[model samples]
Every structure is written in C-alpha cells, then in structure tokens.
Target: MKILPYHPSVLAQAQLVDLINYCQNTEAHLAIKMAEQADIFAIPQVYQQSGGNFWIAQDAQQIVGCIALLPLDAHTGVLKKFFTYPPYRGQPVRLGAQLFDQLLNFAQQHDFTRLVLDTPAAETRSHTFYEHHGFRRITPNELAVAYSYPDRHSWLYELQL
Candidate 1:
C-alpha cells in the first residue's frame, strides 16, 4: 500500500465518498448523512486550500483508506474523515495507521502544536485508536468554539504534539 497526497480531479471527490460509504456499511455507528457533511463535501475549500491537506491510501487494487487535516488555526489542525476500508481496517495491512502517520507527519512539519478530532460515542473502536495514539478525552467545552464538528454532541479528543 502507498499513501499519497490528494490531487484534485474530477474523480477525487467521488473516490472519497465511495470509501466513506464502504466504511459506513460495516461500521453502523458511522451513519453519516452525506448531505449534512459540509466539510467533507467541500474538501478543497475546507482542507486543501485552507492551510490543510488530504491524503489517500491506495494499493495496486484501489483506494483503501483516507485521512485529512483541517487547520483550525496556526497552532492546531483538526483531523477529519479518517476511514479505512473494512478489509484493510486492522493489522497486517495497517492502512488506518499509515494514513494516521501521514497526517501526523504533515502536522509536525507544518508546526501544528496539537491535533483534535471528535467521534460519536458509539464509535468505541475509533475512540480507542485515538487514545492509543496519545489523544486524551476532552469535554466539548474544552474544545475551541471556532470549529464545528459534524457531531457536536460527540466525544472529543485532543493530542498535544
């Protein structure tokens, strides 16, 4: 598998949405309403053009994972849309971890002091992954008011870099 920076093109958005659907199908907790996900729908405006970036994990077969970093400010970047295709979701391939490491390396190089993300309370697997990566649970009140997550009522996490 290879992790590459996303390059805007006609099929880029479609590929991403397809990957999201693939993940959502198995992880019922991620019942994402595509229309309601504005940040993801407008990837270029929300991420690529706003001091942030998006990446995809592709193998010889297809895109197996995706991750994006949305800069909330000079010191912080919000990790977004992290999804791994079911077949490659865990060990052996470790696609999700590779995507995450790409995001982390980008964050550090960009001088981001912290990374933040929120997940639905039911997404225990994702929560554990983030926590294992040094993220600590934070109350909604602890997160800054400037950013709006799709799931405002979700559990929040922050990792100090």
Candidate 2:
C-alpha cells in the first residue's frame, strides 16, 4: 500500500467519490442524502484554494483510504473526509493510523495550533479512535462559530498542536 498526496484530476476525484460513498452508504448505513454534496467532487480545488491538502491511501491502483485538512484559519484546521475502505479497516496494516499520523505531521509543519473534526454521533468506534489519538471531545456549541454545519447529533473533537 502507498500513501500519497491527492493530485487534482478527474480520475482522482472519481476515486474519492467512490470511496466516500461506499463507506458512508454500505458501511455506515448513512442516508443517501447524507452522501450527496458538491464538495465531494471538488476535493483538490476546495482544499488547495484554502491552503490545505487532501491525501489518499492506495493498494495497487485502488484508493482504500482518504483524509483532508481544510484551513479554518491561520491557527486552526478542520479535518474532513476521513475514511478507510472496509477491507483495510481494523487490520494489522493500520491504514487509518498511518493517514492520521500523516495529517498530524502536515498540521504541525503548517504551524496549525488546533485541529477539529466532526463525526456522526453514532460512530462510537470513530470516537474511540480519536480519543486514543489525543483528540478530546467538545460540545458542538463549543466549536468555532465558523464550523456551523455540525448537526445537533454530531460529535466534535479537537486536538491542540
């Protein structure tokens, strides 16, 4: 498996869509409406336009995992699109951990003072993963006002760099 920075291209965007939809719909059982969003198709541009980055983990030619870092401000970043294909999740290969570590390194290099993320409240496993990696839970109301999209049931987490 190889972890690489995402390159802006039609093909790369398509792979990201497939990976995200597969994880959200098939694995998480989230409603189709939850997976439909314009940002899914413009990952590189959305991230790059804001001085951030997107990354993918691939095995052979297939994308198995992805993560994005979006700059909320000079000192803060928002984590998004963190997912791992079913076959690569919870295995000895540790794909999620690798991607997360890479994200931390990138945030540090960019001099971000804090990183925040919002995940579905029902995703208990994800909560544990974040907590184990030093992320602390925060109430949605406690999140920055710029992070206005988090729903009432969203689980918010933050890591201080």
The model with the greatest TM-score is 2
> What is the per-residue lDDT of model 2 for residues 1-161, given as tens digits with 9 covering 90 to 100?
99998876777778878888888788788765544566666766788678888889989988889998999889889988899986787768889999998888999999999999988888888999999999999976677748655473788899999
Clashing residue pairs for model 2: none
lDDT at residue 25 of model 2 (Cα atoms): 80
- Among all windows of ten consecutive residues in candidate 1, which has the lowest summed lDDT? 24-33
lDDT of 1 by residue, 1-161 (tens): 78888876667678777888767654554666678777767777878999999898887747778999999899999998899877887878888888899999999999999999988887788998999899999987888748777663589999999
lDDT of 2 at 160: 92
Q: Clash totals for all models, in order?
A: 0, 0
Q: How close is every model to the real structure, measured as TM-score?
A: 0.91, 0.92
Candidate 1, residue 117: how far the Cα is off, in Å: 0.4
Global lDDT of each candidate: 0.84, 0.84
Error of 2 at 61 (Å): 0.7
lDDT of 2 at 151: 70
